[model samples]
Target: MIKNIQRTLIELANIHRFVMRFYREVFMPPYEFKEIIRQCYVVGWKSLPLISLTGFITGVVFTNQSRPSLAEFGATSWLPALISIAIIRALAPLVTALIASGKVGSQIGAELGSMKVTEQIDAMEVSGTNPFKFLVVSRVLATTISIPILSFYTAAVGLFGAFLSVNQNENTSFRVYFDQVFDAVTFLDMFSLVLKAVVFGFTIGIVGCYQGYHSSKGTEGVGRAANWAVVMSMFLVFVEEILIVQIIQAMRA
Candidate 1:
């Protein structure tokens, strides 16, 4: 048990060093704008359909589930505001991050792990290419930039789904429902959403890269890298969510 704990601490220290190196390298030289753009397209655009479907379903199901309790208290009219607060401040960002951890995070780990095992990354190094910058920095920056926008999109889609559910039950008009949503959502809520999205994105990207870049030397290692990336990213995301929520609540109080 003690050995396992020590190994975990050592791994965490290595990760911290890796992150620090990323910061040092990211701002120092020839920017890989094209690579970053390509990664953004892959990470953001390709994930949209899944995000949209998930967000819509989540909103619909949550609204439906909550309707009964609200109806019991004759507070059914508060549905739009309630849905808006829940989705914008928490659900949209958290769900989007979790999905990305599973999808994008695993892909990144597998791709990099393959490159590592095949000596592709080493070849790039020998060829005088800054593989870390071209690959790691670009992908990390792509996730950081894409996630907040995706979170916003998720929130919008979710609200629309909630509106549909509410309209079917209460006959609320689109404009009225949206107005109520906006009215209930504050600047703090928007701030929290963006902040959470960016942090989660960074965590996912960095953890995936770290795992894959340092994967063991085997085909089996590639699979392990991808699995570890997903698991670690999700774990860190939840930890960040809890910490950020606590901080935000303290600020609000």
Candidate 2:
């Protein structure tokens, strides 16, 4: 078990290095700037609506579930502040990471894997086109830029949803709720959480693309890449969450 873990860690480190190298290559000569913009449109704006809707619902459900627990302790009045902190610091980014891993990560893996199996990757090379630059970097950059913005949008919608949920059993204005939320949440909290989301998004895109581009087991390889991308991204996001929390705590101290 220890050996397996060690080997896997080494493999992951190598893959991360490869992703970085490809990113640098993409920026050098004959830039594929168009693809990057297209991907941003596809990954960002197209993803916003769904992410926002889900984020709102997640906030509502989270508030509803936690509200009763706090109310049992005679702390219903604390709902807005607590919910805001929860959404801003943890829930929005974490949940969005999971959703994006499953959605965009799998899509990237499958698309790249399919292209590889079809010999299109070889064609790109034959035509003197850097496939990794045009395809992988574009998508990866899109995800990196998009996820944080989506996370912010999600946070706003989520807070709004929490506001509405609070009104279901009590009377709380949006202004009052947001004020309390901002009061409890520090700038560090925003920076840390959003930074973590950006990292998570980059990991999801790059890892997914890596797995897909390198897969070689025929049709089975494509499926494997998608599966691994989702799993790897989720695990990495969880690990990062722990590391980020520690960093935040250390910074506060």
Tens digit per residue, CA lDDT, model 1, 1-253: 9999999999989998989989998998899999999999999999999999999999999999999999999999999999999999999999999999999999999999999999999999999998889889999999999999999999999998999999999999999999999999999999999999999999989988988999889999999999999999999999999999998998888
Q: Lowest lDDT 10-mer window, candidate 1?
A: 130-139
State the TM-score for model 2: 0.92
Which is the leading candidate under TM-score? 1
How far in Å is the alpha carbon of 171 misplaced in model 1? 0.1
- Please list the C-alpha lDDT of all candidates, in the order they appear: 0.95, 0.87
List candidate 1 stretches off by more than 4 Å: none
| Stretches of model 2 off by over 4 angstroms after superposition | 1-16
lDDT agreement of model 1 with the native: 0.95
